[model samples]
Target: MNQKPVNLFNTFQLGNLHLPHRVIMAPMTRSRTAQPGDIPTDLMAKYYAQRASAGLIITEATQISQQGKGYSFTPGIHTPKHIDGWRKVTKAVHQAGGRIFLQLWHVGRMSHESFHANGQPVAPSAIQPDARVWIADGNSAGQMLDCPTPRELAINEIKAIINDFRQGAANAIAAGFDGVEIHGANGYLIDQFLRRTSNKRTDIYGGDIPNRVRFLEEVVETVVAEVGKERTGIRLAPYITQRGMNDPEAIDAILYAARKLDRMGIAYIHLVEADWDDAPVIPESFRRDLRDSFSGAIIVAGNYTAAKGEAIIDADLADLVAYGRWFLANPDLPYRLQHDLELNEMKERATLFGGDAEGYTDYPDCQEKAS
Candidate 1:
């Protein structure tokens, strides 16, 4: 067996910040927040800064508007209070010497009317997906329910939504984020437009691949303008096998987008290469295409181990590898990697979502320390 290099400890650059390693803490939705709105609490700050050992931290998807919401207790970046809350979070992470980025998101048709502030869900087209979203009631805890048909966004509405993302990027900077990441992945709003199955419109926002990607292109341009191009990144799930989200020959679309983003000088592109089981296998051709297209960093995620991550970096497939479940359970993940320590088991899925601090902050680090 080949021994891994201790120089994994070498520093790297992510936009304006220097990282201590190449292990990234991928953004994950814990769905733990206060009621009425998704506000970051002091405990949430500690939870993030505790995991600061990561080379870089990409925050959980934060909705840019009320209509951008999908699940209950998910954070947002639309209001002053939200920015203030995130201000505390970014300060804590920076104090711990961690560089973080805020992921700007809009769920679009993935959300139900009840989740929207005006009780009206919005999307590219007025289509309802055969999906369910979680809703929180003051009396009852929460429940997974059906989604409703969304209001088709007019051309003007589409422009406004782009502006909203620009504002979200500004808010992220005000909150002290090192950068802003555009969430164009999963089955969310941006992905909804990218995939032909979800986006069925004759307008400029939909039709062929370029038209379908118009929303994402505009968003990238808008955000890059708000925050410098060097400080902007994008998360795209161009080949997700889960949730029935996929486009024919998805790699072509991804490469096209990556090349386009490269011309814009974006910081990095995060590709979620996971199957329904959350296992990852990047096709050789796809990996090469990504490496050739994007001159910047490429971060791959979904069930990647320390050894596997090192293999990817060695293969020149990606600059960094993000660990989802592993980082969640082990706050000192980078230390564990350096010392070749065993990782803690993942928390029970039954208690993963919509909790205060039970599974949120209760996960033990590599060693026990005084609170």
Candidate 2:
């Protein structure tokens, strides 16, 4: 019989980095990091290595500094221990023939005092949103708590956060990552700073759209300086409205920013369509605008299947498709796509956020059956 068609194995490139397939693994918060300000652990290395067949794997959002943390048990890239932990992860993934990128992040006002290093939450503005964050204590299972009022960031302090991102990129390089991806999404510090609803400031970091985007631009430049433009990537959830964060001109703003990054020669622009499964459609005009504006690879994520992912790539709207939840239940997701095999059901929602080895590294692979 003739071989079945599988667009999942289609090769692509982000700048000079050639990928064997277009199945990019979406960044996920596994919350398995070691205690007292979540540091990457041996389990993380094993977890990532198991999923290394992904054309590219973007690690869970890693806090760049202590203030960057919003939840307990999430990994950080600030401390020496964190870098050492991630070094093992990168080595494992590399040995498995996978490419990985470290996503630099800061939660800003989305955090509570419990997760902070200085016992205070920081934000672009002093406003508090109706959002909940997960908290963890040894022996007492994780629970969701309401977000607290945040302190407004000073101009100088804002500059310091930019420097922190630069330091994070440096640490990521030391950790042996192939590249760094800026987490300017999901109501984090950069997204909080960029969104007009969350950011009500009079400084240069706020005001007009360009001004709101200044912090992200500075961060991109900082990381590019450390790792060079060819190895830099950015993850944006522009359409997702969580924690009262909204950008009326999100598409325009990000596309405009994409043009700038393209001109600067940044690697990829990974866009998360929405927070939920039934995400709103991105207009053809807008998709084309992004395609025309950005010369580098474009990766789109948010509950997409192999067929829909292939359709997007075939239409030239995206260069690659990122699998979020599907990648969680299926380790050999690319192989499954190649063979058109049935995907495992993901019925356990509570098992996602915080856990030990179960429900995480326990996901069986397709290769196991073949053997």
Candidate 3:
């Protein structure tokens, strides 16, 4: 006889948290943080609180330090003001009955010179990525600016950044966050270190696969030490080739790192798959390999619909599904998915970044629309 099928709406035990369902809100950088200090605002708090029904909400990429910043208007977790700002957000989410995780970020070479005081971004190596980051003009309007060649980080700087990750985790806890997710994907600082195309160093943190993964390993170890392995998760992108991130050995390196993370007993590994219309599909073998390597929970995100999400969970390839754009427009996404309700389309594409409540908190839920 066949056993019962697992539903996406069923409860899941992710590490120390008991999630009500398997629908997660994937992290999306809206670049809407308060200006001057890159602090979270009441508007951001309202936006997160409005979507508290998700099983879990991974906040938009938050810089762990001023040097970690790349895009304009994105929030940070380094300063006292940032912690206080985030406290409001976490309090609002908890009151609304939602669990949230802060994604610690450092863009590395995916940054422009404007964000740095010395006019140089830091990375594992000096290789320049063919990427553009949003830089706000004096008028508060932003435009994509090309990233300049970054200066390679010294040995001491690498250790400092690791400590920064540790401090970021501690700060998140102080701000009442349930957990923290290290942004190790999408050609960021960590990703640059993990890829050969970006890292050309000869030190202990470069060269072979083991050396290439050393930086990430150190960062994870430090973060886990600060906030236990159970409250730590990481996001990795293996199939992404854009933004000068076409590393042929990325999969092997990621798998190697996954095995190490499994030994450390981290809570979960969130995979950011290619989501473009013609993007190459992640093969089934890789999924099985990833599951085998990491015994803990796995969350997959990339334009996944309700049916596709259920299928992956049913197949035991992934434990949770994260929706980015869908949750952006549908504050009541889980309810709508469970009840087959219509999702609201994004009203203005321009309002997606660096804007106010028009596309941020103005999206109505099903009940609100009905009433």
Candidate 4:
């Protein structure tokens, strides 16, 4: 007799937290933080609280330091004000009975000069990525600006950034976050160090696969030291080739890092597959290899529908499924998906980035719409 297949709504034990279901709310940067200081606002708190039914809500990429910032109006975790601001968000989420994780990020070369005081973004090497980051205009509207050639970071700067990750983890705990997810994907600073296309250094942190993965290992070790391995997760994008991130050896390097992360006993490894309409499919062999390499939980995100999510979980390829755009529009995403209810369509593309409650908190749930 065959065993029952795993359902999408099945309860999952992810590290120390016991999730109610397997539907995770993936991280999406909405550039809605308070200006001048990049602090979380009451509106952001309400927005997160509205979607508290998710198994886990991984917050939008939050900069760990001022230098980690790339896009405008994105929140930071480096300052007293930021911590206080995030406390409000955490309190609201907890009151609403939700678990949240802050995604620690540093954009590296995927940044413009305007965000830096010296007008130079820092990266593992001086390579320039063909990427554009959103910078808000005078009217608070955002524009995608091209990134410039970034300055290569010194050995000391790399160490400092690792410490920044450690501090960011500590600050997230102080702000009452359940955990932290290191943004090691999508051509960010950590991703830059992992790929040969971006990192062209001769130091110990460059060259072979082991050297390339050293920076990521160090960052993870430091964060785990700060807030235990159980509360730490990481995101990796092996199939993503956009924004000058098409590294041929990226898969091997990520797998090598996954082995190390498995030994380190981190909570989960979130893989971001390419999501474009015509994006290449991730090979099944890679998935099996990844599962073999990492014994902990695995979360997969990239335009996954409810059926597709259940299929992956049933196949034992991934433990949890994260919905990004779907969760953005449907605050009660899990309920709707579980009950086969109609989802609220996303409205006003302009409001997706740096706007107010029009597109953020005003989306009605199934009950609200019925009433």
Of the two candidates 1 and 4, the one with more favorable TM-score, higher being better, is 4
- List the candidate 4 regions with Cα displacement exceeding 4 Å: 1-6
lDDT agreement with native, every candidate: 0.83, 0.85, 0.94, 0.94
* Model 4, span 293-335: residue lDDT tens: 9999999999998888889998999999999989999999998
Candidate 1 per-residue C-alpha lDDT over 195-273 given as tens digits, one digit per residue, 9 for 90 to 100: 7777778988888778887888899999998899989999988667444355684566667778889999999999887
Q: What tens-digit string does per-residue lDDT give for candidate 3 at 63-89?
A: 999899999999999999999999999
Q: How do all models score by TM-score?
A: 0.94, 0.95, 0.98, 0.98
Residues forming the 10-long window of minimal summed lDDT in candidate 4: 1-10
Candidate 1 stretches with Cα past 4 Å from truth are 1-8, 117-119, 278-281, 369-371
Name the lDDT value of residue 163 in candidate 2.
92
Please report the TM-score between candidate 1 and the true structure: 0.94
After superposition of all CA atoms, the RMSD between model 3 and the true structure is 2.3
Stretches of model 2 off by over 4 angstroms after superposition: 1-5, 275-278, 369-371
Tell me how far candidate 2 lies from the true structure as C-alpha RMSD in angstroms. 2.0
User: How would you encode candidate 2's per-residue C-alpha lDDT over 1-371 as one tens digit per residue?
Assistant: 13443666788877667899999999998788887657898988998999999999999999998888888788999999999999999999999999999999988998988766666799989889779888876763678898998999998998899899999999999999989999988888888877888888998988888888888899899889988998899988767876897668777778778878888789889988874667566778988888899888889998787778778887888888899888888888888888888777764767787777777888888767557
